[model samples]
Target: MNKLNHDQLLSLEHPFVKIPVEKFRSSLRTSQKHIEKEIGNLTDKISEISKKSVQGSMEPSQVEAALEAIVNRLSTLKRKLKDIRADEVLYSQRTKVRLQHLQDFATIQTLDSDEYARWSRVRLNRIVIDYMLRDGFRGPAALLAKSEHIEDFVDIELFAQSAKVEEALERQSCAECLQWCKENNSNLKKIKSTLEFSLREQEFIELARERRSQEAIAYAKKHLTPWQETHMKEISHVMGLLAFPPETKCHPYKRLYDKSRWNDLIAQFRSNNFALQFFTPEPLLNVTLQAGLSSLKTPMCYQPEHRNANCPVCDPETLGALAMDLPLSHHFNSSIVCRISGQIMNEDNLPMALPNGYVYSYNALTEMASLNDGKVTCPRTGAVFNLTDVKKVFIS
Candidate 1:
């Protein structure tokens, strides 16, 4: 012990400590800035592209291709940015926790007792989820969703304007069985009633208006005559949207976890508030799952369609036990095959269902781009490291 001086030890330790903190902070700032800048830049490009297209300088195909390219880039960038942001917050949370532990150590140093070691060992992080902590907390989400890519968030079929629907109605070649309300001799006496359902200001619903449109279409088909099918495919198509209800509201993973479990833990942390700054054990209930479901950003116009006085999902007690964060009522049991002949997308990104029968959930696609992220691997190098690996290194 006498061989090395205290100055020598401090020199080595100081750099090892300072370097990690500096590196993580710098990386966090830089990563956030990079994503923010790219989002801004792409937004400007999309605006410019829209202006050029309106000026008739770009072909429809060219405009579409350009938009698709932006979608691809935005997806990649968003996925990367979200991951980076999550990592950034996580890093900060860890550092803050560690710093708290260190502070406790310093405070207990002059007490002539070893309670600091015991206190640090108690581990306080159990009270919160990683995303809820001060360092990683999310602010208001609506303010955050102002990105230009936000429109891509809404997925619907027949997203065309009302003007387009009117044009479709005017085309006599459109539907063999359908007649304009003004020209329907068979229903001349029902003119006023028929006119109420006319397409002058109507909207068309095509493709996947939402995930389970197949159900809505089947429901509509039950009421459609053959002539109705030919004349009102667009109208019948929108009926498919009734299969699933919209998402009306969503909460953060942390809020759900805390809402469900905080009452139980509050009593437990009574006398050891300071001692909790240390190791937070992995939650027994999967926090990530809780967070994922709880943190869902609800879509617009989601009115729960309950036929009775009761909520369809079941009683609050059962739901609470099951996990309040998850919308258990939602089902992904339906499958659809694309009607047109073309390549289809598979979950694993493999070529499947040629000639377009492969089904996709528009909601799933939008959420895939915006809401959450699966782990990433470098396509070329295949480099991957679990967060636990980083945690272990930090702890040691």
Candidate 2:
């Protein structure tokens, strides 16, 4: 496999840059279903009335009543169609604005100085806001976004919607979550998601744990019964919990009543919702940082003695710690820089190896020699060497 750096991978496959066609399609599908159902009902009613007329059983009064009803249905259908058209136009305008912002990211380098500054400010704010939102620091995120006036670029509302469901899940209430599941029931079923079933299971467990035997049983019969075909084994396992008391020493049943299950449901809901909306599971800040750090990481960065004070990858406080798990950049050829001159040792400025195994560019050694009576000192070790003794090294 060809190893691509984070920048390349993100440029090619970042979820943020991708158009949310699935989300749009999902909304359109709901509207299409409603419109089709209405048309179907209207046609069926018309067909029935026509059959009555053909049978010669329709009175004049019935004719007038049928005509009024048909006109009313037609009017309602027209209104619905008009509303859908308005919604479509509104959605298109919003999508175009968002697309314009996304395009700016790609063409930012081509912008003028003032434009670049404004874009950079918005981009930085967006990254910070994204990180804050993901970490549940919505108060701070909202403040920062409002102050910066970048709310339109950030996904504040999207995160808030999912956060509400998550908060309900945390409170041990599956109501909002279940409603969300119902709204996206078709998509969930298509993906064979276990989220809804899991939520129902948690509900049953909660009732059983509270010793509400009758209520638990009724809940299982109504909510859990539908999951039998796909989750029969799981259903059997959970139903067995009722036989054992909530305080029973049985490990399996005890685990079912664990409070951590709510956290699990919250996580599942976030993951499923993010997937549905085509949002990345991780914060964009973390993703961008990882990519940047990985591109700068090297084997020497881990060694304390070889560390550079100005190097981010060598600073243990922040970036270094973050880049610990990242792979080093792939380099087919080695690069050496002069310690004294801060210049690369290439064909023109050849590297000179000292007796102490330290390397410096020939130009740096020459400059040091000119000042130190033809004696060069190694920056790291502080060892002195005659310029004549420093052998020129050639890198293959």
Indicate the TM-score of model 2: 0.73
| Highest TM-score model number | 2
Per-residue lDDT of model 2, residues 48-135, tens digit only: 8888988988986897798788788778877876776665665555466656766665554434456566866777787889888888
- Among residues 3 or more apart in sequence or in different chains, the pairs in candidate 2 whose N, CA or C atoms overlap within 3 Å are none
Query: What are the models' TM-scores?
Result: 0.26, 0.73
* Best candidate, lDDT: 2
Question: Candidate 2: what lDDT?
Answer: 0.80
lDDT for position 170 in model 1: 41
List the global CA lDDT of all models: 0.37, 0.80
lDDT of 1 by residue, 129-243 (tens): 2213222232222223223222111111111222232344344222321243333343334322333222211211221234445543553454333337344754543343343
Candidate 2 at 253: error in angstroms? 3.4
**TM-score of candidate 1 against the unseen true structure:** 0.26
Model 2 root-mean-square deviation: 5.5
